[model samples]
Target: MTGNLTTIGFDADDTLWHNERFFRVTQDRFAELLQDHTPVELDRTALDHKLLAAEKRNLGRYGYGVKGFTLSMVETAIEVTDQQVPASVIQELIVAGQMMLSYPIELLPHAQKAVEQLAASHRVVLVTKGDLLDQERKLAQSGLGDLFDAVEIVSEKTPETYHEIFTRHGEGPERAMMVGNSMRSDVVPLITAGGWGTYVPHGLVWEVEYAEAPKDSPRYNAIEDLGQLPALITRIEDGL
Candidate 1:
């Protein structure tokens, strides 16, 4: 089974197109708006903690998207300030969240070439999670749409998603590998499902799910970017 792979799943957002930079910009704006109520030292951290807590709490009812983020920010603000935070601040977050305009919408530096090479030798699947319409529009605009054998825009990534994905593509767990930027969204679940995964680091990952996983963990490997994907895959399979 070594060095022989039939299928690969990729994550979209920060892994393919530019995603978190928009959120960073909006967050900067958000901090500026709330400066009057929260202290200078508490400006960013307080708001961030509040929002993350709120989002996780409401994750089930709302799901992850601009609307959830916006509502979370508003509720977080009110929670911290103990007053109705200005509607104007929430509106700014809302505008930033539209997300149609959030991403730069260009494929990462070598995403096209890496995908091209992998597809020539193995099956390629784009498994991204986000607001469905915006995610689809991004792929359509990316011009890399036809390259993938299957494109999965999921609400969440769990062992079940991986099982369904591999079964649908007729690819076995041992024969498939998932690639992406987020550990929680991509690597953790795949490993849990007895599948392999390669993590390509992004400049800005979402804050909530950021952490370091032990290198000794099987089914986990890292690459600098998609440019190194082809070799990286072989390197991981070699059990390096």
Candidate 2:
């Protein structure tokens, strides 16, 4: 009942530290910057839709992180303004992206303790997707970086990705477990890879990261936060 897991993987953004909230704040700033450029009253809903569409369209080209999001914002601005958006607005958007890159990493409640506790018994790895430099900077600032046995900054998280990472870092997917906030990136694919996928919800989630819960999967789990992770792990190991 106590040794089912050999490796514990964690998601970086929103899982270990504050991430999406800062993006939300920057999005509001994005809307404000575009207000003067638009010919008519700007609809927040419509703008958000355009921005989301742009993000989806640009994912392949830009990948993920502040740099990509900033580019999407610029594209949306130009589209909404009929290619008449000011150069000054573009400068402000670039500056905003810079600010996001430099934002201080704020660890979520119980994140450090949970990782530290699990690391004592299992190989703990940071498996997150984002820009390489940005992710590295965040990890360096998080203070929890030293606790992890390994770190992986990937372009995406898929079943194959989980399988490879788990096998490389620990025994394999069967003896591994992943804890994170995104049902899509951090949970579902991990479950598909034959590992325990634990969902720890963070209130602010990116739209693209949203996915329906896999309630029927025996390996799927949901916890309110990382604070509850250790107990949940104990329950799973006990075969409850």
Candidate 3:
């Protein structure tokens, strides 16, 4: 809502461009890469869950981005294969990460229009968490770089991070709003920090990023897509 929102922060990955799709595709490839080692009857769903577990365990060490995810996939391969995983498989996993890092940046439906429209009324900033170099590359390739008042590639999206971002870029949390796909990283923390939190759930969610929605919170709202953002902001400004 624009009532007290002078700055609106957006999450860059799945929330803006096609991100999680690449990861999902790569994960499928990962499953196939390790399929030979596991029993034929080993459930694919269980394997996927194991990979997710590895990723979550390594989040602190590798942080969030393709590199961290790639490492986790490699670790999972080794674990699933009982430390006998082949050199070629690890090589392929590295190649998969390379492919993801270089993958084309395809903006989500109405991402550009929504960003441009919102920028007209509010200070729109890109507040995404990930590997700095890869995130910078995506932003540059997205061609929507100039649309943002600022671009912040953060290590994590905690209350302290959001607070610092708002304080440095504009007013504090009361004058800010965060729009993203992650309930844990994007919405909950900002809302906890006294800012508006708008959840825009994507079809393919990273399991590690999932958290129960704070639906009962008055400051939180979940929208279907970015296309709805402009009108939502307008409604808030209109006090409707």
Candidate 4:
């Protein structure tokens, strides 16, 4: 029962490198800025809720990345401050976003080894969703760019997206596998598109990417990290 996989897709952000922690840090800065504008002591949980709402509302218009998240923060700040969020606060948020865009790319442990090993025997593709320019910048810095046979930086990840990408890059979804940190974006959708969805959890995940695991799906799998990816692929290939 050898695996039918012809192409293996990898998620960029938190899957291959550090991503969410920077967002968390900027979010903390956002909270502090908002607190200074209000007289009452801020409730961090409440503020987080408002920010998440803003992000969700703006997703369609702004899509994902530091630019969208920055805009959402500004929108949330204005709403939370009763439309009186100061200019300085907004400026700082903008600076924060720039800093995030410029942050150094730190490859996650075993990321290079995992991708390199898989690429030797499989058509490796990078299928990630984000602002195109920023994703490209990260890839250029990662030094793993040459390892991928192809790269797809999309606005969103869905079943259709996976079908299109895998088909274009390899055989098709049925003969491909997608590995990433998000259950919603990286795993479930690929499984729905008839590919194996392999979940690799990151330390911090964006709330919006949360989704229930497809425990009943035979194509679904999970690994502790990229370090374990090669072994898992072997097991899957062996039909174990």
Number of the candidate with higher TM-score, 1 or 2: 2
What local lDDT score does residue 69 receive in model 3, on the 0 to 100 scale? 93
lDDT (CA) per prediction: 0.78, 0.92, 0.90, 0.92
lDDT of 1 by residue, 97-173 (tens): 66435465777899999999888878899998767777777898898999999999888889789978976884666
Candidate 1 Cα lDDT to native: 0.78
For every candidate in turn, the CA RMSD to the true structure comes to 2.6, 1.2, 1.6, 1.5
lDDT of 3 by residue, 1-240 (tens): 246679999999999998999998999999988888876766799899888888888989988999999999999888888899999999999999999999999999989999999898889999998899999999999999999999998888999899999988978887888999999999999988998899998888877788999988877888999999988877766667
Backbone-clash count (model 2): 0
Candidate 4 yields a Cα-based lDDT of 0.92
Descending-TM-score candidate ranking: 2, 4, 3, 1
Model 2, stretches more than 4 Å misplaced? none
Lowest summed lDDT across 10 adjacent residues in model 1 is found at: 95-104
Better of 2 and 4 by TM-score: 2
Question: Higher-TM-score candidate among 1 and 4?
Answer: 4
Question: How many steric clashes between backbone atoms does each model show?
Answer: 0, 0, 0, 0
